[model samples]
Target chain A: MGMTIAEKILARASGKSKVEPGDYVVGKIDLAMVHDLTGPLTLNVLKEIGYDRPWDPRKIVIILDHQVPANSTVTASLHQQLREYANKYGTNFHDVGRQGVCHQILAESYVKPGMLVVGADSHTCTLGALGSFATGIGSTEMASVFLTGELWFRVPETIRFELKGTLKQGVSAKDIILYIIGKMGVDGALYCATEFTGEGVERLSIDSRLTICNMAIEMGGKTGIVNPDAKTLEYTKCDSCEILRSDKDAEYQRTIEVVLEDLVPQVSLPHSVDNVKPVSEVEGIEVDQVFIGSCTNGRLEDLEAAAKILHGRKVKEGTRLIVIPASPSVYIEAERRGYIKTFIEAGSVVCNPNCGPCLGGHMGILADGEVCVSTSNRNFIGRMGSPKSKVYLVSPETAAATAVEGKLTDPLKYVRS
Target chain B: MSAIKGKVWLFGDNIDTDVILPGKYLVLTDPNELAKHALEGLVQDFYKKISKGDIIVAGKNFGCGSSREHAPLALKYAGVGAVVAESFSRIFFRNSINIGLPAVISKGARGIIKENEHISIHLDEGYILRENGEKLPIERYPDFLLEILKDGGLLQNLKRKFARRGEV
Candidate 1:
């Protein structure tokens, strides 16, 4: 029987010729990641079990993306502990100022094709855009991996999403994913491996592909994978590497077809990531804050998109706009390109590269009875602030346009020179 | 594993990690401190209301978003004996097991179980005994997972394994 790319990757990691769905295999870890929020718990678990050192320090990656710069005394202490642990173990650590979002940092260089990766953050599946079978695990499970360098898995059945045609001007990979999640519902792909393929996927830039894969977890996907192609090779600067792809006759539990040419700006209403609608349906709803960064949409292209929209315009008088780059590299590049200046001139507060307001970790939290138009993933209830506050998830362009009007506005509704 | 008896708390679908334990409280490491915020997003003062050994019976897609293990740890520390749901998100399921929280999947758990009613779960026997004297079948844990549960979570299980091999 033919095997999918995920099955093939699992087979290689497990030292088997092939693996079928539901088959259990204990696989070696190529890379493991954890951030400030989850890292301390993992170390504590190891200490409780009396394992003082990681199996392979170099294989582990730690970062201070969440609550960076220390939101409180507790967070400062947690960051201190992570710094100590990273020093003791000699693991690859990206601390404050040097850190962006965890997944974004991995995408910058750490992630490579065909590797079996795991992280303590659910959004770790975002790394799968690099063609790795990466997924999220609990901190306790990560402790086991830290010591043994191995974790068991029940191979998930694969769900293939084949996109075709060109994306509309204002429509983005974020919209495409939001539309899929809306149709599939929250548990539509529970415990399943999702593969994004077809010509439309090939049309996506590496950053856009990352955006699509980052939201797979919103629909309960174990991981979202994209086949490594020429664009992927260029991004990773790989001269020679095995580019894994599914067989022509490989089986998929189900296949969803998306026609990208017909897609428009999509928005996820407050309280749920999957409660989506066309931006036109919910346009003009007032917003108090606008966020333009997170692991989902904090890449260079996303910043450029927002900057382009906000370049010559001013943010509405009553609204607040906050832009955060995903990583230091993105931060430098955006600054070099003057997007940062454009944002500041537009009356938006451009923060450092970290997860701000997305998880309500820090930087820009919503107040009671307020509404926010954000480009981040997951609009779950109270995700950004008070339980009474509401969040609407939109594309970067939409976020910027909404910021301009202090309401939910479609990007295409305005004309740019 | 012995049968666990607890009062029931009913919840709807998609009780995500943010609701289970909001991101603002992710900074806290102590389980007891984390417990104070359990379900605070969904139900105010829920932790104070919960008696030790209260089971949560939820609709489909419980623990749907975020891979924060704090969610399960908070539930465990908040005196939740087990979580009986129609289904659960993959990461949540794994986190629950790793934290020694029993997350049982019984299709009709929400419909058959009433809030504030008492129920008993026989994990090893693969059924939940409700106050109505009805036995509801649950999806049994696989052998490896069952072993982890028997040892009271992955931490203890790993300790036992390492001790046997003389690695720690």
Candidate 2:
């Protein structure tokens, strides 16, 4: 039977000639990942399972990007445990200040097209941008992967997102995804594979495609994918000449058509990614914080977009803005482009390359009753800080404008002519 | 074996793993510490209010997020007798099973479960008794999973199995 790129990759990886959605198959994992927070727990689970050594040390990666610099003694202990675990197990460790976030670092160093990657973090689906079938698993499953280097998966039904028309200036891939979430609602893509295609998607850069697929979880998708094209190959540095694409007769659970021209800078209102509204509709809603980071949109392009708006303008007083580069490499790139200087000059706090305020652990957490506009994926209650601290999801451009205006303002209105 | 009985609390769709155990507390190694934050966001004072052997019934996609085993660990530690959802996230479902937490996917469960209604789960019988004494049939868990739960978790179950086989 004909299949999409995702189906074909899963089938090949699972050692099956043909596999359809809903078929439970166990497959060898090409890449496995764990971050600082969960790595220790997974290692403990591995010990409990009586696996003294990792199945393949080279295939395992440990990233210390969350709670970088060790926020507290507990976090310090976690990092120390990860270091020991990596050293003892012979797994590759990207210590804090060396690599960026786990998702970005994995995409940069290891993820390849058509490979099956699993991580202990949910956003590991970010690797799907490179045409890989990447999904997140729990610590115990990760421990299993550490021991046996294999995982079980049910081929999820695919949802095709066909994009058309060119995106308007200042409207980014983040806006397009937000617009999709708004239309589909939070649970529309639940437990399904989301595959991006069409002309609009083709126009997006590799980083942009990663942004789109990274937020798949916000809509409850198991994983998201963009077919491996030149952009994916270039970003992934993969020389595998076997380019994967969806078959013409491939079946899909659902197909959605998004015209880029019909889209605008969108925002997911407080409480849910699907609670979306156009920037114009929510104009003037006050915001106390603006965050521009996470695995979703912390790339150089994302920083450049925000810097373009923050140039020569200071963040509004009483509005705290925090920017985190997704990876150390992206941080360097942003510095080379002077985005960091621009942000700093504009009074924005440039945080280290960690998932700091996005998960509400440390660094720029929102206060009670406060509202924040963020470039991160989810807007669930208590996501940014206190349960009462509302989070609004938007593009980096919108976050920048909100940081400057101290309110929900259309980024288009603030884009310099 | 004693039957686990509980009252069911119904929730809506897309109840993510983050809502179960907020990402901030994921670093905590102890299940009890994680349990304190279980459902703290969805229902304030959930840990304080939830009693031993209470069940959580939801529409779909229960426990969807980073496959941190802590989510189920927190729920299990918080005294969630079992989780009956229309569907479960892949990782969450597996983690639930590995941790010996009873997770069943029940069709038409949304209609039968009411918040604060008494229900008795008969694991051996593959059914739950509603407050009105109606028998709600459920999918029977695999024998291996039942044995694991009976042993309290995968670790203990593995220990027992290995010991019985004299492989240790």
Candidate 3:
């Protein structure tokens, strides 16, 4: 049988001629990462496994994100513990402020084509945008990889999404993903590898592609992969890595064709990423906070989209807005572009990226009964703060417009200009 | 590998890890501490109501968000004998086996079993015998995964490896 990109990647890593769905293979790891939230536990598991150091320290990257600058004494100690371990093992370490978000750091620097990347963070699948077979692993699994440098896989079946059409104004990769999720509930692609194909996918900028692939986890997918093109090579800086592609006659569990023009700016309402509605129906719902950040939508372009709307306008009275760039470099670029200044002048709090308020990790946490419109992914109950508080997931444009009106507002008006 | 019987608690589809164990309690570092909040987001007072040996029969994609092993650990400590969902998120499925918790899948279990209905499971046999004496699809452990559960968990499973390495 012809192979899909994911199957091809797995087959190569496992040193096999080919692997099919449901077939088990023990694959070698090219890279593994852990951040502050899971780093301490992952390293602890390595010790329990009786490993003095990682199998290959050079291949491991450790970053202190999640509760960075340490939220409490315990978290501070956690960061300190990770720092000591990284120093001892001589693994690549990006201590607080050196790196912004863990996944963002990998995207900007390390992730390359045709590699297998495993991370302790669920959003690790974000790296698949560059054509690598990246997915999340728990601390225990990560430790096993640390010891033997190989982890097993079930060789998930691939679901191809062939995107076609030109996106209308205000519709972006985020809208297309949300639209797909809405159609394919949370479990639509359970344990499946989703590959983006066709011209529309190739047309997406790296930032937008990151937004689409980052939320693959929300659909219960193992990973969302986009084939490598010139844009991918330009981003990863690799001369050539075998850009794996699905054979035309390759079998998939199913294939979805997404017509980009049919999509609109979308929102995921309270408590579920798949609980989506068009912005027209959700407009005017009062909001208490508006945040634009995370590994999902915290890139320079995301910040620029929000800045374009907030440039001369002050944030509405009694409403709050917070902007966070996904990486320190993105922060510098946004600053250079005056997006940061416009955000501050518009009365929004710009925070150093550390997954602020996205996982309820800290910074701008919601109080009881408050509702937030955010660009970050996931709106599970208490995902922001109080279980009673609510979150609506949107693109940066929608989040910025919501901040201005103190309610969920459509982004098309701002996008047209 | 043996037969185990329990009363079941029914849950619906897309029950994510956040709802199983909220992100707030992630720092607890103790499975028992995390257990108190299991399913609290979906079924308030879950810890208080649940008894040992109770089963969680859920719809598709149970335990889907965040690769937190705590989600399975929480359910295990909360006294769930096994989770017989329509399907499970892969991370949660792996974590359950690594932690010695049995996560079973049965396509017909959801519609057949009611909350508080008694059912028995056979891990090696791969079937859930319902109250009516009807056999339904249950989680069947493959040889490799059965090894993880047989050794009692990944920790024990790994400890044996280190011991064998020493002999080498």
Interface RMSD, every prediction, one decimal place: 0.8, 2.4, 2.1
Q: For each candidate, what is the lDDT?
A: 0.92, 0.84, 0.87
Tens-place lDDT digits, model 3, residues B64-156: 889888788888888888888899987888888888888888886788788899989888888888889888976567798889888877867
TM-scores for every predicted model: 0.99, 0.95, 0.97
Which lDDT tens digits does candidate 2 get at residues B109-158?
A: 87778999988778788887888878888877666667767877766665
- Candidate 3 structure quality by residue, lDDT tens digits, A1-417: 799989999999999998899999999999999887777777666666675557899999999778777888878878888899889889999997686888899999999989999998888999999989999988877877877899999999888899998899877777888889988989888899988889999888999888889988898899989988899999999896777777887899998999998888999998989999999996999888999999899998899888998989889899999888988999999999999999999999998877888878789889999999988889998888888999999989888888888889998988787
Predicted complexes: DockQ each: 0.88, 0.53, 0.57
Candidate 1 lDDT, tens digit per residue, A1-417?
799889988999999998999999999999999999999999889888887688899999999998888878889999999999999879999988788899999988688888899999999889889888999998999999999999999999999999999998878889999999999998999999999999999999999999999999999999999989988888877777677788989999999999998899999997888899999998989989999999999999999989888988999999999999999999999999999999999999988889999988888888899999999998888898888899999999999999999989989866334
Candidate 1 lDDT, B1-168, residue by residue in tens: 999899999999989999999999988889999999999988898889999999999999999998889999999999999999999999999999999998899998799888899999998899999888999999988999999988989999999999998988
Model 3 spans > 4 angstroms off: none
DockQ of 3: 0.57
Worst 10 residues of 2 chain A by lDDT: A43-52
**Per-prediction tally of clashes:** 0, 2, 0
Q: Which residue pairs show backbone clashes in model 2?
A: A137-B67, A138-B67
The order by descending TM-score is 1, 3, 2
User: By summed lDDT, which 10 consecutive residues of candidate 1 chain A come out lowest?
Assistant: A408-417
Pick the TM-score winner: 1
lDDT digits (tens) for residues A1-417 of candidate 2: 579888888888888988899787889998999998778888677567564467899999999987898989999998998898888868899986685788899988888888888988878888888899888887866766776677777788999999999988879999988988888876678778899998788789988988999988777788889888888888888785466678989999989899998888898987867888899998998888889999898988899999999999999998988999988889888999899999999998998898878888888888899998899887777777787789899999999999999999899977746
Chain A only TM-scores, each candidate in turn: 0.99, 0.98, 0.98
